[model samples]
Target: MKKQNQKAWFFVLPVLLLVAFNALIPMMTVVNYSVQETFGNNLFFWEGLGWFEKLLRSERFHAALGRQFMFTGMILAIEVPLGVIIALSMPRSGFWVPVCLVLMALPMLIPWNVVGAMWNIFTLPDIGLLGYLMNHVLGIDYNMTQDPFAAWATIIVMDVWHWTSLVVLLSYAGLVSIPEAYYQAARIDGASNWSVFRHIQLPKMKQVLTIAILLRFMDSFNIYTEPFVLTGGGPGNATTLLSIDLVKIALGQFDLGPAAAMSLIYFVITLFVSWLFYTLMTKDDE
Candidate 1:
């Protein structure tokens, strides 16, 4: 018993130490900053929960938070069902499977900054293929920089194009893992394609769907790069997301106290919603 316990500690200790060094320390520092105010020249004062109270009352924070939630909600609604449909349509076996998988994975391999930059260039009104086609070929006034709705649409479309592949890949993995016997049984019972998918594939893919939704939600909620690069949160704060606003406060205006407080609130909101998602998703599993 003593030997087993010692071996278990040996395996777990490294990971625990790594977590402490990497995550815990940085988190503690943020927590400390969130509750304090600092002036230049190394002066610090304990403000307690003053920052938090101010954040809760700030209309700017409220607007940004609402917009962030709207973006996240739209992303999940669009990506989840679309990914499921695409996954279900993909061939289970054949020469095309690897080809499809590789193609799907390609977008995910690109660096995030590159993805943002690419979209930024690709949406240029005069030079970009999409911009040219939309403006000239379709005979429509479509410039994301000028139109708020256009900017929002472009951002949503860009995100879907970039990240939908993640959901596709995860759902595909779940679909493949489903035993062949289940399909065979469904076929013997004369189940239609819809019935097979509804009764069999959907149920089997639940866990992966949960994981994919959670990942996409958190990522989209905290999204800062693509939209930032594409829009600069510009056209007069038309796309000023919480992250963009947070950065504006932290670095642009150099308000560390308020920024730290906002960041702490951001972290708390993410944690709470993530917990809510996990509970709802896995409640049925239990």
Candidate 2:
């Protein structure tokens, strides 16, 4: 019998300890807060499931959750197909590949808060370039602050601009990994472009696309900063996603029990939906 190496356990132990400290401890603290009401410093009262029950029945929670779903659904619908199309259009080789990749990655390189602030300034009705163009040159009423429709459009557009690049990069990676022999074989068989894509490209890219969909879904569902900075959840709660609403409850209203319950609920929903997506997408493989 050969002796197994035990030294690797030492390397993994520190990471496990770090995760327990950072994630597990905080999670336990949230769980504690969820079941108990805090009146002030060192004062707590058991609330049991009251907060969870209340939140489940709350209209505000429902509305925010609905908006979150809508946002995530729209993001996945737009980004996945657009990313694939952009990837397909990209050059397989030569001078433009690096340039195009860099450009696609540029939006993603910016910090999330900066992206929000940048768009906020870029869409100001008076001084902003796009705003001026729409209002003056194009003669359009495009104030996101006052109009719900405009607000939705602006946030959606902003998200697409910022995140579609992730999908594009993933799709491009999938595309480039395809062996040239597949194309050669397709040509030998006189396969049409559509046929080639359907039979070869789409199948090969399915895994990456699945990854892209899940990532976009989670990010869009939990998104807070950009939309908050851009619309402040108004004109009147038009874009108050669940995360934003959770923060409003936790910080703004200072409701610890309810906020903790909502946080747990939000986390569970995300985890369950992501699992569902992954299972459905990969079921055919199994």
Candidate 3:
């Protein structure tokens, strides 16, 4: 029998330690906070799962969660298909390949907070480009700050603009990675475009699309910075996502116990749903 090298762990030790220090430690802190009540002077008392129970029953929590799911669902529905379409439209190989990729990548390159701020300014009623185009040029009463529908539409559109490129890039990678022989064979078999895509391209892209879906789901689900900056959970709680609500409880109301519980719950929901997605996507493979 060949002996495995035990020395490989030495190279990976630092990374493990780093993860523990950064992720594990903070997680432990959150876990601690979730079960305890804290006042001032770093004092804490045992509260058990009271906060969790309270939040579970709270109508406010339910509304925030529902809104969050709705937003996430909307973006996923829009970004995935739109991304695939855009990716399919892109040149397979040419001088425009790099140019197209660069353009697609521009939105993602901007920081999240900056993206939110940019969109907020871009959609402002008075001096903003989009707002001006809609109100003045198009003669539409499109004010996101005051209109709930407008606010929702703006956030959804902003997210789609920012993140759909990610899906496009991933899908393109999957598409380009497919063996040229597959296309040639499909052509020889007199395969239709729809048939070629349905069988050859889609099956090949499954892994990447699965990855894309998982990434988009998690990111959209946990999203805070952009929408918070763009909407501030307002037009009066019209778009208060789960993360925003958690922040409000933790920071605004100084309700540490409830906030901590909500965060843990939030974490579990994200983990479970991501796991569920992965499992469902990969089940046939297994």
Candidate 4:
């Protein structure tokens, strides 16, 4: 039997310490707060799992979670297919490839809050470009501030604009990684474009697609800053996602115990859904 080198653990010690300080410590603190009620000057009282029970039965929590899921679902439905199509349409090898990649990357490079702020201004009915196009140039009633549907649509479009590039870039990478031999074989067999894509490209892209879906799911589910800045969960709670609700509980209402409980529940839901996505995507292989 070969003896594994224990010295490698020393090399990883710094990362472990960093994780403990950043993640583990905060998580432990939240766990403590979840079970304990707090008052002024760091005073605390035992609350047990009462907060958790309260949140579990809260209508507000249920509504926020439903909205979050709907937003994420719409994002996935729109962004994934749109991204794959964009990637597929892109040149496989050419001077335009880098330019396309750069353009796709531009939205993602913008700061999250900045993206929100930019959209907020850009959707102003009087002066903004999109708002002008919709309201004046197209003769449409496009007020996100007043209409719940409009507000939801605006946030969805804003998120898709901001993050679809991630899926495009990932799918593009998967597309470009295909060997020339596969194409040659397909050509030799007189395979149709759809056939080639269905048989060759689809399988090749599955791994990356899985990654894209998981990433988008997690990020969209946990999203806060952008939507908050853009809509403030507004048009009468039309876009108030679970994260925003969590923030309201934690900071707005100063209900630390319930907030902490809600945080843990949110964390678990995200983890569970992400795991389910990964498992279902990969199950076919095994």
List ranges where model 2 is wrong by over 4 Å: 1-12
Weakest lDDT window of 10 consecutive positions for candidate 1: 1-10
Candidate 4 regions exceeding 4 Å error are 1-13
Question: What digit string (tens of lDDT, one per residue) describes model 2 on residues 88-146?
Answer: 99999999999999999999999888988898888888888888889988999889899
Off by over 4 Å in 1: 1-16
TM-scores across all candidates?
A: 0.93, 0.95, 0.95, 0.95
Tell how far residue 283 is off in model 4, in angstroms.
0.9
For candidate 4, write residues 146-243 as lDDT tens digits: 99999999999999999999999999999999998999999999999999999999999999999999999999999999999988999888889999
Model 3 residue 51 lDDT score: 86
- Clashing pairs for predicted structure model 1, backbone only: none
RMSD of 1: 2.5
lDDT of 1 by residue, 97-160 (tens): 9999999999888887788789878878789888888888887888989898989898899889
Residue 179, candidate 1: alpha-carbon lDDT: 97
RMSD of each: 2.5, 2.5, 2.6, 2.2
Compared with the true structure, model 1 gives a TM-score of: 0.93
Q: For model 3, how does the per-residue alpha-carbon lDDT over 188-235 read when each residue is reduced to its tens digit?
A: 999999999999999999999999999999999999999999999989
Each model's lDDT comes to 0.90, 0.93, 0.96, 0.95
Q: What count of clashes does model 2 give?
A: 0
